[model samples]
Target chain A: MIQGISIYEILTVTTVLFFIGVYGFLTRKNLISMLISVELILNASVVNFVVINKYLYPDMLQGAVYAIFIIAVAAAETALAISIIINLYRQINSVEVKDTEVMKH
Target chain B: MDLSTFLLMRHEIVLLVVILLLIIGEVFIAESKKSSMVHLAVFLFGIHTLIGFLSIDYGSLFGGMFHTNALIQFLKNVLNIGVLILLLQSGDWLQEKIIRVNRGVEFFILLFSSLLGMYFMISAGDFLMFYLGLELSTLPVAALAAYDITKRISSESGIKLILSAALASGVSLFGISMLYATTGSIYFTEISYVITADNLTVLAFILFFTGLAFKISLVPFHFWTADVYEGAPISIASYLSVISKGAAVFILMILLFTVLKPLMHIWENMVYIIAIVTMFIGNLFALRQQNMKRFLAFSSIAQAGFILLGLITGDQLGTATVVYFLLIYIFSNLAAFGVVQAISLETGKEQMKDYEGLYRTNPNLSLIMMLALFSLAGIPPVAGFFGKFFLFTAAASKGYYLLVFLAVVNVTISLYYYLLVVRAMFLRKSDNAIPYFKSKVYMRLGLLITAIGILVIGIYSPIYDYIYELSRNLL
Candidate 1:
């Protein structure tokens, strides 16, 4: 039989993972890598949502519904984003964020 | 439903109808006559805005998932006027660029969808309703920010916006879930009743604030703003700056003053810290910007910082100040961007140096720009001054004297950069300056109306009194 850990530990771990993902996103030089890091950050939140829902307000199902919606939206967002990235790569032949930093001071 | 119920729903229904018609019209309109569809959509939307103002009775629906009090109705009208000016100014640019044609109709649809979302978000009484309304407003604007698909930077802007927004939304959702876990309900009014300075509730409030702060592009969450603003087209930037930010501020005010009042001790300190950092960082970045769009981007961010002053107040006076300031800010910022849009259309140049001796070529546009910049800098004889005055007074009344003092100093720093643009336009001379160009009648008329709004609102005090009454009804 598996013994479940405490809810506080779950929340703490999820929060830490989110901050790590945010760090990577801010520090990453490549746009695609940053996007991946963002995905991690979003996933961390989904985990927190599921955990919170499991622990509290299980009757409402609002948290679970919200998680589903977020996942669907995230998928759609990534699909559009990746295709745009591919197009940009086709034209510029590079995906490094530094190479695309032309419109700034 | 009774006549009163029907009357209460009119403003939202009108906007919803206009959005549907525009979407359907986009499908059927022939390629050659598509512009006619755009025109018709604008006409319908304008009429919808007039109807929104004509609305007097206030009501809620779907258990307060949506509402339209006098304050919200007035704001919707303000948003309509802002969008109308943006549409008029952007027409020439959109028409000239072949790549951006069909997207114009989609742009309008997405814009109204976001506006509709904002309408509900401002009046949302429950956390679930608020979250839904927020997503409705956010998702489309992210798409609109990257509407110029042909450009690499445009796509980049879209990706950045969506990614950040998703992260912010998810974090905020987690926070909301925590709130539910703590309070045993998701309704904001219920949570407000239960919430206190408890650790769980404070953490939840912080997370929620972070999400909304990203929307407003406040400091620490503002990393994405300049890049996205610089990358997107000018029209989209104008929308992002004026309409989207205005709507977010509206919801923030509502949430802080009403739903989250119990969490004040925790979030008030957070807002105080965020406000100071946002003002400082935004001003520092704006000072170094060369791209006209990026400059405005940071400037708007700093303005967002100042608006946080009202949020820190947590009172009806704070709400009134916010509405009044946003009303004035809409006129000033959009006017400044209108002049920039008009100039960029003729010359395809958007640098400050490119604007050298602009006064010599087109004195009218330059003068309009000067007034706009002055207003943005919170100078006398313009609306921005009055806006800031009310905001500062609101903050001071709450005994936030330190934030008020720092905001005043930040205002001084802001004046320097706004005047820098004026100097570039009027004092400097470039040998290769283009000859004076004629503006489209719509562009000129928009600028004239904005200038008048700035002047009249500053010189007159009645605007404040009227918005105060509206805020009283709102609360």
Candidate 2:
């Protein structure tokens, strides 16, 4: 384990951040807000990977490498999400969740 | 380091080459002949599928990051077949003036990349590889979902898919980190050795299951399905429903049966409840859908539920049955979707009311639709019946008789809604029914293949036997 910060403390802080990200996902009105919330969700896991790796297995680089991959993938996902949101804006002129209702019955 | 070792990765390597070929072909092809790219892509993919049936070594590679066995190779072939049929069915639609006039080849490249991702996913030997495969598979399809660039609904579907996908990825990653923290290893083989069913691991498993459940559209995570299907183009909708869901289910089952076997007691109960809820919710909601695409989306969810029956066994029976059922599912679902695409292409009608008196005007297409739906509904003498039968037998063998009974009930409920479509096409009459029109060669060929698959695979017993033999290595 890390010498200074307890593992529980790191995990506790991450747990809160994870829930905050989820809360933003549920409460966000605009697509951009939702997108940002998703980034937060992704980064929470990134933090968990790096912190857990540092605390538990400081010798191995596996968790650190996984964190890198997660970051790269989350970036790609955000780029696609933003492009699609822009496409939605082009056709509807609004990004609100309620405004994106061209699909339902 | 040796040349012989590369034999294990032939499927992925050849697919990568095909993707690069398409990209290069795109640049050289004349702008006026861009639509011909569809023909070239379909032809090249057909070769890839054919090559997939060839034999390859069963082993792990890349320090156990990549793994393949007979079962994984066979599933890859099944997915390749599904994608090939998808390309065939999409050929006509892609060439239409309303879509794909300029960017015709992007659809194929994106889809192939996604398929490449699935190939890695189902064959992954460790958590990190699995996560990378999952993301690669999902991101390209989000782009494809929004392929109909002119339509607001298409882009809306893309957004919904990516958002939910991002959340699912985050949730699964959290689960994986916890798992790594506990076991201090990411390799499936190693983790399985040291893993215990503690509370933290249980919580992690639940999160991981939820993430995959989103991909499979199981119950609470299924909210994005119908809306996305309704909004995306017909081809992308079918791709999501079949190829994508099949890959997710395949990987979920592999992880549960192999990597998480120690936690079977906890998860079987979870699977038991999920199977019932997913089946009921998917069927009941499907009954109300008027749009053909939306109807298929719910039906696919129900099919994913049926797949869970096989999963609960956590044995070779579960593995074999799931793979066998997915093979039949790919053919049956594609046939259904191919018919929908053909009709939607000829005329702009997508509602059930438009299908009234369909038999009177287009008897052949109606017959294909009937066959596809009957297979989907698990009627007698079709591949779907056998698929569901094996799944129930797998569940029943494990003495989950109550779960088996509930699944039977769900099958009966599903039959009702599937027959509803048949009733509209045959029993009801409308003056404005879709007029008889011929499909292009590719579309006809696609439907014909699925129709033949639906017929021949049911009575053929050897294929199921072969799958059972291959799946024996899993548990």
Candidate 3:
């Protein structure tokens, strides 16, 4: 445990954040809020990569590089999500998840 | 990399060059001449598919980040063939878009770009490359799903697809991070060397499997499929149902048989239960579907379950059967969707009730639909029967008798629903039946090729032998 901070503690925090993000994603109805929840989930993974790289495999920078790639991908994903939300809003004047169920049985 | 090593990536390079040429043509060509771009794309992809078969070099690049071999070549060529058929069947849709929205170039561009991603994904030797290629392949497909901007369902499908895809990938990335933590490497070979059946690693494996199950539209993760298929354009829907799902299954098989081989005892049980649930749920849901797209969606889900039968064996015969099934599935599913597309384009009707007495008006199209549906139901003498037979044989080889029995029951349940559509088309009579309409030359040719493929692929023994040989070398 470096400086009294253990890897277990960090992983615990990230796991909590990940589940909270999942809860928000399932409960929330707004498109933008769901996107935010997705972002939180992605960020939790990013945190996992950085913490794991620093503590366990400091000899190699591969995890750090992978984390960077994840961040870039999350950015692109967010852009696409926002554009889709805007398109949905234009169609029905609302971005609620329930409003998008026009293809129901 | 050496020059010879670079030559091994010829399929991807050719695809990249074609994409560039399409972009240049989009800018320089006048509005009226743009339809020729579709022809160019098809010609180039055909050449690409032929080249893939000819160039069979086995090698790895970037310290095992990417690998290429005869099996990968075969899979890439299969995808190229699927895409070429998609292009052929999409001519009418493309002409409509060119005349109305003027976005035809963008459609082909997005498709080829997504195909490029699949090429990288099938060849990826490491988790990082796999993740990157996955995102690259999936994002443009969301854009393509929303191609019909005026349709509310189209944009809504885009939203659901991208959001769910993001969540799945995030969960999978977390799993990858855990695997990296435990194994100390992201490359498949390195991971395989150190992987063990510990609790944490097992959990990571399940998480990763869930992500891929979403891609393959397995039971629990398949909520997005029906809606998306119903909303997206028919051409894109077929692409998603066949090409994307096939690529995912291929990569998943590779990862399971190679990187995660050590944890087979755990995954085999998980897959056994999932397969049972997936097959039952898919067929039960398909039985009630009124929309053709939704019906096909559930049917494809059941097909994914059948593919899992082969996955459970994790042997050469298993792999060969899965590949063979997917080849037959590509032709069968596309033929079904092609007929639906032609009918929908002509009449703008998508409901099963509207298809009553179709045989009376459009005998040829209805006949094709019946044959395709019969194949899908695993009737004898069609490609799907042979595909399912081989899959069950592979599973039974592994002593999975109960699972095979359950699968047989599910196949019976599925046949009822498949014949429901056939009954509606051939047996029922309606006063307002769809008129006989001739499709474009390209659509007819596309449908003809897939129809012939469906008819003859089952009787061919050499193809199965060749697939077995390819699967033997996949590892």
Candidate 4:
């Protein structure tokens, strides 16, 4: 599609990364690791935008701009998540998913 | 932006100024004197609500990335009213406990910031603006959920909230990217003109809907709701239930009705299944809730289900009913939570069992709680009944009789659990019941206003007609 690199190839890579991130998110017991998985998922979307912009809509820079905004938002989300994890750790002395079930019926 | 464009955002500008003044006051004022910040916030927000009603500007800004109309203004005003009530209800509790000393400023700051984000969200005309507003609204709430640093459940809820929100938003962003790739534009007007119901587009729509579903706490995505509601302070819990959820519903309704109108066939069917599941799961879980907050959380989830009935119709009547229902819901939910906050502040009890013989000790509060619950259960002569009636009628008009029937059955199921709380308060007797306590002026006033709203809004046809007129111009 573009200089020998196909849009479908990039999409396939992003889709795989997205699924891997979801799998890690579901399986990981540690909070920080799960946060990292979320970051992966967000980056997959970033990659998606870059690829789509570069290949499909090369006339406009809107998709690239959206990618930048997404990166900034992802950074902010990570900061908030880490702070919350630290707060939870201070209270329970653990960051494991198994230990956070304090409100179950 | 020109002066006229700036004038269109007067309510937001006013709020921004108030927040700045609050920050300035916090910096210059002494710790003891900083208590006045609550009064200042309440007064400013009250005035802002009044000004919002007078703001009749209808236009777009930032190359159609933001929109403002009578509908957005109306919703913003309603949110301001809800927030005002929240501030009033949380006054005594904050002054005495929870927000201890000078830390009250940060609580208000976080809340106002979150409200600001919701305002932007309600007006967002593009995907990027919507995503920005969504994150801005959400991240601060995680902090509010964990406001009580001393409580383990508080921080736990905060962690759960932020993690799930991150996952949901990320998934939604992926969907947005898909949509952008398909349509080559992020602006709602542009996308609406270009979108077609292709397979990839359908996938993108479903993913986007799922993300919003998490915000509205619909069914499978609702696992975090009760936990967060139970752990967060009563003020924050009510804010989550009413203000945050209300804003999300407003924006979601607009997006579905306008930008995604072409894909209504796909979404309507999806919403049909989600609504039935959400109502059933919410009511079933509510029956098992020992904690009052969790009970209300599930109850609100069920309410979200009923709201979806209107959403499925995708017509003027549906829009009117949803808007009207949210207004009634705000008053009804706040009244209930105000009572809980008062009782919890007076006595350190938060269980259903703790509410036994409540009527004998605090008849006024128990009565307010009963009225609020009656409205929520959609009993005759209360605001919730008319709200539910209109929603079902809207769906029925669309020939969705089965969905309407299921919703009625869900209403009946919901009434049982709502009555359970009433029964606990009125029928059961306990030796250690919370004694009669005099609520502060603000709490009483807040409850009284909501109680009046619960009673008056349903019986008055003018308000419903007015909302109907407003809903017609939503596009």
Candidate 5:
């Protein structure tokens, strides 16, 4: 364990961050904002992996490696999301979530 | 360290080669000859499917980061067959619509890339590989979902799918982190050995299951399914509904039955509830759908519910029944979607009303549609009946009698809606029915294959034995 920081403290922070992202995702109106919330959500897990690995099992590198892969995958996912959102914006005048309801039953 | 250890991944290696060859072929092949790419893809993939059936030694690789067994290989072959049928069904659309405008080869490339991802996702022995494979399979389909950029609604669907997928996967990753925190390892075999039913671990499982539920389009997470299916191309929609969902279901079952086995007491109850909720929601919503795509979307969700019935058993019977059901489902769902594709491609009409008096004009397509729907509704003399029967039997064997009774009720409800379409086609009449038209040979072949699969797979009996044998690997 780290000398100055407890694992519980770090985990508590991530729990808050994760739920904050969930709230943002639920309440956000703009597509880009929702995407940002997703990034926050992903980063929370990324931190959890790193912190948990550092505190609980300093001997193994699996958690750290997993965190790295998550970061890289998150970047790729964000790029893909932005491209799709851009296409949506081009077709419609707005990126607001309300405008995407052309497919209602 | 010898060469043969690597050959266990023959499916991935061969699929990668086919994808690379297709990329090169697209670059050199002239634009006017673009149709050849479709034929090339289908041919190469057909060869891949044939080779996949030839067994390889089952074992682990890369310090057990990757693993393959009889069960995984069988699932991959099932997927290969599904994609082949999809490609055949999609060939005409690519040649006529997509090839004329842009490099048509991309459709194949993206599809193969997604399939490659599913391969890794299912075969993955560790969390890193699993997460990577999951993302790989999903990202391409989002692009495919938005293929028709000209249609504003299509792009809209694309955005919706990507956003939901990202969020769902992120939630799942958090679950993985929790699992790691609880077990201090990401490898499934290792984690299974040390795992215990702690509160934190249960939370992790629930969060992780949200991701699978999203992919499977279980209710509450299924808001995007109907919209996405409505907006995407018919072939792409069918691909999403069957192939990827099948892969997701396989991985969910494998993980639940293996790595999460110690937590069975916890998740069985969870699966019990999810099974009931997904069925009622999927069936109830399916009854009201006017558009064929949305109708099938809801139907597929209900099928996913039924798959969970076998899942709750957590035994060999559950495993065998689910795999067998998936094979039958692929044919039945594809046949239904194939008819939709052929009709939409030719006439650009997708409403239930368009099918009225359809039998008078297009008797053959109507017959295929009726057979497909009957199989879906689990009537006798078709593969879907056998599939549903086995699933109920699997569940009943474990004494989930209430769940089984509810599923039977859902089946009856599902029959009403499925028959609604048949009613429209045969009994109802209309002035402007879809006129007689011959599907391109590839489309015909696709439909013919599905028809034969729906008719013969259940009665054949040996295929079930093979899948049952494979299921023993897990249980």
Candidate 6:
């Protein structure tokens, strides 16, 4: 909630958040953790959208509306993905990507 | 922007109707007729798509956020045909599962819904509509990616796809925000005027390009592609690789030629660098893939790199090249997947080693696989060869000689791996090879359609002329 911060600061924070998500995605072994990383990345993007919408083009709410749709879609995607992961874990008895190469040539 | 204008194009109206029917089918269709429901949906879509092609009168809708020029309409028709073939090829695979879990109509519903999204995405005239359409196209396919809940790999693929899509969408939105901040407009037409050779605009363009690169699975963003394609079901993998990527290519062509025209110098340079990297990385990875799907996944990435050559030109000829290349790509890629689907069903094996001596057991499939692989490698007398030729020519026309030269080198590298599949089928012999693997009538018919499409389009010049004229008018 820093007031009168420069546009560069907002962009920097957004980039930092995105990098953190990338790191988590790269390092995380658990599938759920990777999914969370994705959520983090998505949020970072929404934050950038909001800040830009407020500061740059207040007239066009398209960015803001798009941000909301991303949230909704991301949530739906997470629900479906998690359910599939749980189902797969039940069948294969493991969630490690290494064990799931059943269809490889 | 008028509501009536929104319904002006026959394809748009048909697309909307199909989407609604799919949603309704999911909610109201009885379990007993679910298989029939899938067929009904496919038939309905086929007819509507044909009508859309036959009734092509160019018009714009919603001010300029939706377009229905002949080129895009033809592209959409090709996509529709591709999806229909996919559905047919998947019928047997889908039938077994639908009966098991009462999934029934839901599968077709989700599929058509995804197609609806892609339709809007290809036709989108503005950033807002484009973004919306992309999400709509993507989210359902993410679900479809993990349709086989019994397999851990299916779930993993689903999760990976969702995470990747989320990141891509988010980053893309941020870029859009930055664009709006700089230009004070979200409409693509207006943004074209606002983008100058400015640092901020260039930054925004880079950010935007990254998001799209993720979708196309270019280098540095392609890690998920092999895994996801390998993990997902064959039908889903084929859909993701051909249909989703095709839609993105259409959008990319439009954006580069129209909206991002002002920043052509900046982005074209970036595209050239990316194209080379993507081709090399894709070919190198593809060579190492023991899994058939992963092999094709990497090959598709390499193909995307080739498509970028057309986009890099940023002209009417480039647009024609991309559109024509995509049409050819649909046939070649889908044929490969169709053969793979046939074999996978027969033997439940997807490894190259499993395909050892496949030629003796299933000569037809082996031949199809050989043709598909050769076409992908740009061997002459195949659709894929012409596709690459057009893409390379378009780039060379832009004085991108180095890029074209590197691309030719990459094509040679790709030929090696594609030949690997041919070698496995012909030279190596499997002890426990599948004997007389038979596909369903629909699948066989579908494969034949795609095969003929590959051959006819390659040998014919009139098709290219038609596509070129359509591109000129549309662009």
Scored against the true structure, residue B208 in model 3 reaches a CA lDDT of: 83
Give the DockQ ranking, best first. Answer: 5, 4, 3, 2, 6, 1
lDDT of each: 0.82, 0.91, 0.90, 0.91, 0.93, 0.82
For model 6, residues B1-475, the per-residue Cα lDDT tens digits are 3456555566667866876787787668776666666566667777876776676557777678787777788888888889988988888777766644777566777888888888888888778788888888888888888877777677778877877887777667667767877887777778887678688778778877776788889887887898899888899999999999998888887888888888888888898899899999999888889888999999999999999899898888998999999998998999999998888887788988888888998898888888888888889988889889988999999899999999999999999999988998999988887788678887888888888988889999999999998888544
How would you encode candidate 5's per-residue C-alpha lDDT over B262-307 as one tens digit per residue? Answer: 9999999988998899999999999899999999999999999999
Output the TM-score of candidate 2: 0.98
In candidate 3, what are the lDDT values of residues B1-475, reduced to their tens digit? 3577777778889899888988898899888777777777778777777777775678888888989978888888888888888888988878866534678788888999999999999999999999999999999999889878889999988888999999999889989988998999999989999999998999899888878899999988999999999999999899999999999999999999989999999999999999999999999999999999999999999999999999999889999999999999999999999998998988899999999999999999998898899888899989899999999999999999999999999999999999999999999999999988899988998899889989999988899999899888664
Write one digit per residue (lDDT tens) for candidate 4, span B306-382.
Answer: 99999999988989999999999999999999999999988979899999999999999999999999999999889
Candidates 4 and 5 compared: the better one by lDDT is 5
Cα RMSD to the true fold for all candidates: 2.6, 1.2, 1.1, 1.1, 0.9, 2.7
lDDT of 5 at B237: 95
lDDT of 4 at B261: 94
Report lDDT (Cα) of residue B302, candidate 1.
Answer: 98
Q: DockQ of all candidates, in order?
A: 0.44, 0.82, 0.84, 0.85, 0.90, 0.53
Clash-forming residue pairs, model 4: none
- Docking class for model 1 is acceptable
C-alpha lDDT of candidate 3 relative to the true structure = 0.90
Model 6 ranges with Cα > 4 A deviation:
A1-19, A27-30, A88-105, B1-4, B22-33, B473-475
Model 5 captures what fraction of native contacts?
Answer: 0.92
Positional deviation of B202 in candidate 6, in angstroms?
1.7
Which lDDT tens digits does candidate 5 get at residues A1-105?
A: 668889989999999999999999999999999999999999999999999999899999988999999999999989988998888888787889998887897
How accurate locally is residue B373 in candidate 5, as Cα lDDT from 0 to 100?
98
